[model samples]
Target: MTDHEDDLGPRVASFRELRGMSLRALAAAAGVSTSFLSQLENGRTNASVASLRKIAGALGVSPAELLDERAAHTRGVLRADRRPRLEGALGVEKFVLSLPPLRNLEVYAGEFAPGASTGANPYTHGNAQEMFVVIEGTVVFELGGERFEMSRDDSIEFLSSVPHRIVNESEAEARVIWINSPPTPDEAHGA
Candidate 1:
């Protein structure tokens, strides 16, 4: 793990603010306490691998990015498989498929087990937009008063500012590639 990964709170917090998520909101989304997140961000404590993965997921980064600022500063071609996975709750799984720092946008590929999701209630960001495709198994998407049953190769794109939910009903694992960009408040803005 890199220094940031070793001391993940501050970097993770920075990305939270970047995404316009409150400590309470992020803590809720990551399945951790706000106080714990505060401590981590303040550099008063070290995060577990699970915790780091959750924070990285919420921040739309790979677990490795928090540790390796070098990648954040490195400018060149990067391999998709080499990118890091963002951490989430104990049962949830998410990762940035491939993203370079300072780019104004972020993309991710996430896997949710049979009963996991982003969180209990939906979350919103500034002008945020997300698109996801079910690469395998089935994904249940609740967006804008619609319940979409997405199977393999099914996809949906919408304003993330709207409340949403995701679920995997298949006996097999559910895999989705999601892209989130420009934060929240930008939802009403032009594409």
Candidate 2:
């Protein structure tokens, strides 16, 4: 295999994880078999152009984004307008601040409309360390069995595995930031 082919599998795996897609889920969306996707992700096989296109389409990214390794490794400025917004629960806007090939860390900036929330129920992710900082307004954060009301500049650190949710009960919009070390793959694409 060529160098690009060697790197393709890991890249596919990473994007799949980032999109919070299971192997079966991606396979179904791409109209490919689970074993085929697994083999492709494990570097045991390569994909045809059609297969690559389907996978990229399912991931909501272009084929070039999947094929270009430099897009993930290059040091460049990510303009504000170009930041990728994550689709999540209503009234909440989450933007990924970190670039591709997320390695040790990931960052997200969030905006919550009045009375907005992550969801009615709390959720958890992988075991990475996480930190949430309130940039503006107030928000109520539920972690495990406890609840904490945080305001501007207030920050909380916890494991990503903890069940947590954020609510902006205030009358105005609330802004926040999330930082995770060793990037959490589960729920990485959304909240």
| RMSD to true structure for each model, in Å | 12.8, 7.0
Q: What is the per-residue lDDT of model 2 for residues 1-191, given as tens digits with 9 covering 90 to 100?
A: 88888888888787877755689988998899999999999999999999999987776677887787865333347898999998878999999997654456889999999989999888887888999999999999999989999999999999988889999999999999999887878545446
Number of the predicted model whose TM-score against the real structure is largest: 2
Q: How many residue pairs clash in all the candidates, one count each? A: 17, 0
Q: What's the residue-level lDDT of 37 in candidate 1?
A: 91
Q: lDDT value for candidate 1?
A: 0.69
Instruction: At residue 99, give the lDDT of candidate 1.
Output: 50
| Candidate 2 Cα deviation (angstroms), residue 36 | 30
Provide the overall lDDT of each model, using Cα atoms, as 2-decimal numbers.
Answer: 0.69, 0.85
lDDT of 1 by residue, 156-180 (tens): 8887778777766667778888776
